[model samples]
Target: EPEVTQTPSHQVTQMGQEVILRCVPISNHLYFYWYRQILGQKVEFLVSFYNNEISEKSEIFDDQFSVERPDGSNFTLKIRSTKLEDSAMYFCASSGLRSTGELFFGEGSRLTVL
Candidate 1:
């Protein structure tokens, strides 16, 4: 099975700096999403993208956050001005199903801000 892959599995950055997390979802999947788990907390949806545009986004995906499908095959999340509270394990998921449907999750990229 083709699974999602994320780069920089773990990153440590300074506060106020910028960080870009990259992901490659299943090639045949139609819907792509980004979610984050704050350590021991539950998984939270950040944003969903489809057909080159944002389909849905949660409050967590604010002005400082952005998503892009720069090359059609890869999806990317960029966090501008990193903060201490931004540390979490970000997951990339994709599915051939609907918004409220099932999804496949990546290994996750852990972000740590100092």
Candidate 2:
């Protein structure tokens, strides 16, 4: 089955540095989303993109953050200024249809900010 894939399963970065987490969403899907889970916290939606534009974004997706679909298969999340609280598991998800509300997620890209 086609699946979402994320790179650099683990990353350690200093606070205030820039980081780009990469993801390749499942082919043939129309909607993509990014979510983050802080240690001991529930998964929080960061943003959702479709048709090359942002569909929705949570408050957590502040000015320092941006997302792009650089190609037909690649979606990327960039953080301009990381913070200690940015340490979390970043998950990339794709869904074939928004009506079903079913999402397939990558294993996750773990980020550690110190």
Candidate 3:
């Protein structure tokens, strides 16, 4: 079975520092996305990427955050200057279509900012 893979499943970082979460989706998927869930809260969409550019981004994806597919197979999210509020379980997802298709998601990369 094909599934998404994420590195550094648990990350502990100091506030104002930088962190990068990496993911590799199923080989055949086209669209990639980053979503996050605060502890005990609903999941929120952060950004969506397609065709090597961001197709949509939420308010959470402000200037301090960035997403990139440096290699065709790896999608990464970098947080510049982390904040305490930035601590969350960040998920990477992929789909065969833009919408209406099932989104396959990696387990998550849990970030803890102190």
Candidate 4:
């Protein structure tokens, strides 16, 4: 089965630096989303995209963060400036429907901000 894949499963970065987390969603899915989980916390939605435009974004997706579909297979999230609060497991997910479908997630790209 096709699955979402993320690179650099773990990353350690200093505060105030830039980071780009990469993901490749399932080939046939149309909607993609990014969620973050702070240690021992609930998963929070950051952004959702479809048809090359943002479908929805939460308050957590602020000016410092951006997402792009740079190619047919790759979706990327870029943080212009990282912060200590940014340390979390970033999950990339895809689903066939936006409202009522299960999301398939990557193992996660763990970010450690110090």
lDDT of candidate 1 over 1-114, digit per residue (tens): 789999989999999999999999999898999999999999999999999999999999999899999998999999999999999999999998555677999999999999
Tens digits of per-residue lDDT, candidate 2, 1-114, equal 888999879999999999999999999888999999999999999999999999999999999999999988999999999999999999999999556879999999999999
Query: Model 4, 102: alpha-carbon shift in Å?
Result: 1.5
What C-alpha lDDT does candidate 3 achieve relative to the native structure? Answer: 0.96
List pairs with backbone clashes in candidate 1: none
lDDT at 66 for candidate 1? 96
What's the distance in Å from true for residue 50, model 2? 0.4
The residue pairs found clashing in candidate 4 are: none
lDDT of 1: 0.94
| Worst 10-residue lDDT window, candidate 4 | 94-103
Q: What's the TM for model 4? A: 0.96
- Give the Å shift of residue 42 in candidate 3: 0.6
In candidate 1 the C-alpha lDDT for residue 77 amounts to 97
Give lDDT per model, in order: 0.94, 0.95, 0.96, 0.95
Which rank order by TM-score, best down to worst? 2, 3, 4, 1
What clash pairs does model 2 have?
none
Alpha-carbon RMSD to native, per candidate: 1.3, 0.9, 1.1, 1.3
